[model samples]
Target: MIEILNPTLLARARETGALVADILDTLRSRCAAGTNLLDIDRWAKALIVEAGAVSCYVDYAPSFGRGPFGHYICTGVNDAVLHGRPYDYTLADGDLLTLDLAVSKDGVAADAAISFLVGDARDAESVALIETTERALAAGIAAARPGARVGDISHAIGTVLGEAGYAINTDFGGHGIGSTMHQDPHVPNAGRPGRGYTLRPGLLLALEPWVMADTAQLVTDADGWTLRSATGCRTAHSEHTIAITDDGAEILTLPRRAREL
Candidate 1:
């Protein structure tokens, strides 16, 4: 369902967005060499509960997934990308980690993801992968404004990823988000400009740009949730929840004191 937030609901959306961003930022800071994935999940749960918010993923059970997702957050590492279920694993230096989080506060939901290297070891390939996704996410947000079509945002994102020599995957991309975790107006990572649903004020969209190093194909891990690159190469994902406005898009999910998008 597509939801256009009213003024009051929009306010709640901003709050939820800030909360989600803050939680992701906190998780990022806590993650490092020797960190356990389950510990990350526990920390996320505590933060969400302490804020009096609800985790959108904890009970999510879609047709594509095995069952209700029991984790508080998605913890993807290295080859793992989307829907990564937290497991027993200790992170090491230079491991690329992706944390995708969605939560609701005051009945409004916001979603975002960030991919970064754990610890001080920043390998060239891993850094490039994370930076590319961040650039693509920024480009996508830039294209989102009143009267612009969803395809415009998709095209902008695709241009950045494609130019960086990464293949685009449309199987899973961004989507409308508000009142709930996911909604209508599916936003692909790549598409023609001027196609799909037109943007309007009050519309909230989660634009995520993710890519695998070598292949566009994905393979589901035995856990039936974590999606990994077919080539087992490194991957990266970046996302933000933005609201279409009269003049432009407002990135609600920017973390506190975060660099400008």
Candidate 2:
């Protein structure tokens, strides 16, 4: 559904977004070589509960995924990209990790994701993958405003990934988010400009830009959830929830510390 959040609901949304961002930031700081993916999940649960918020994923049951995600956060390691169900795996130095989180507080929801390397390991390719996604996310956000169309944001994001020589995957992308984690007006990573739904004040959208190093194809893991690159190439994803306003798009999911600064 396309929801134009009212001021009261929007205020609640800001609270939820800050909580999601803070939790993600805390979890990122805890990840390192020897860290367990399951531990990350536990940390997410603790943070969400402590904030009096609930996960949008744990009980998320969609036709594409195994019913009831049963995990507080998605842990995508190296080849894993989307819907990566947390498992018993130890992160190694230089492992590329992607943490995707969504939560609801006071009946409002926010979603965001971040990709980073573990410990002191940083390969050129891995660094490129992560940087490209972040740039694409910024480009997408820059294209978002009261008068622009969703396609404008998609085109902006796709331009960055395309120029970076990464293959774009359309199977899953960003979408409208508001009281719920996922909503209508599907925002693909790549699309033609001047198309799709026109933006308006009070609209909330989660703009995500993700890419695989070599191919656009994806293979699901045996767990029936985690999506990995078909060529075993490293991947990266970046996302944020933004609210349309009179001036422009206001990023709702930036870390509380970042917002303060």
Candidate 3:
């Protein structure tokens, strides 16, 4: 289902988006060597509850996933990329970690993700992968304007990833989000411009650009939720929720500090 937020709901969306961004930023700062993934989930739950918000993940049972997600946040480590279920794993120095989160507040929802290294040992390949995804995400956001087709955003994102020498995966990508975590108008990472659903004011979209270091294939972990690189290569993911407006796309999920000034 695709939802176009009215002004009031859009205001709530901004609040929810800021909350999601703040939580992710806090989690990223708290993560370090020896940090347990479960601890991250716990921290996320505590914050969400304190804010009187609802987790879009926990109790989520989608056709693509096994059962209820049962976690407050997604913890993707090293080879893990999407739908990473929190486990007993402790982060190690230089470990690439991706944290994806979505939540609803005031009857509105926003989703975002971030990828970073665990410690000081940032491998060259890992740094490059993370940077590429960030750039692709930026490109996608830049293309999200009223009247632009979803394909324009996808094409912009794909251009960056393809030029960076990473294969693109279309199975799972960005999608319309509002009131709910995932919605209609599936936004692939790559597509031809001037195609797909046209953008309009009040439309909300979660634009995510993710890539594996070597291949485009993915393998599901034994947990039935975590998606890892088929070749076990390191991966990175970056995402943000944006609202299309008359001027352009307004990024609702920017960090609180960034939004403040």
TM-score of each: 0.98, 0.99, 0.99
Could you tell which candidate, 1 or 3, scores higher by TM-score? 3
The local distance difference test score of each candidate is: 0.94, 0.94, 0.96
Stretches of candidate 2 off by over 4 Å are none
Total clashing residue pairs per candidate?
Answer: 0, 0, 0
> What's the CA RMSD for each of the models?
1.3, 0.6, 0.6
Error of 2 at 148 (Å): 0.7
User: For candidate 1, what is the lDDT?
Assistant: 0.94
For model 2, the run of ten residues with the poorest summed lDDT: 165-174
Best by lDDT: 3
Tell me the deviation in Å of residue 73 in model 3.
0.2
lDDT, candidate 3, 1-261, per-residue tens: 889889999999999999999999999999999999999999999999999999999989999899999999999999999999999998999999999999999889999999999989968999999999999999999999999999999999999999999999999999999988999899999999999998999999999999999999999988889999999999999999999999889999998899879
Model 3 reaches what TM-score against the true structure? 0.99
Sum up the clashes in candidate 1.
0
Give per-residue CA lDDT, model 1, range 1-261, as digits (tens): 898988899988988999999999999999989999999999999999999999999999999999999999999999999999999999999999999999999899999999999988878888899999999999999999999999999999999999999999999999999988889999999999999998999999999999999999999998889999999999999999999988899999988767444
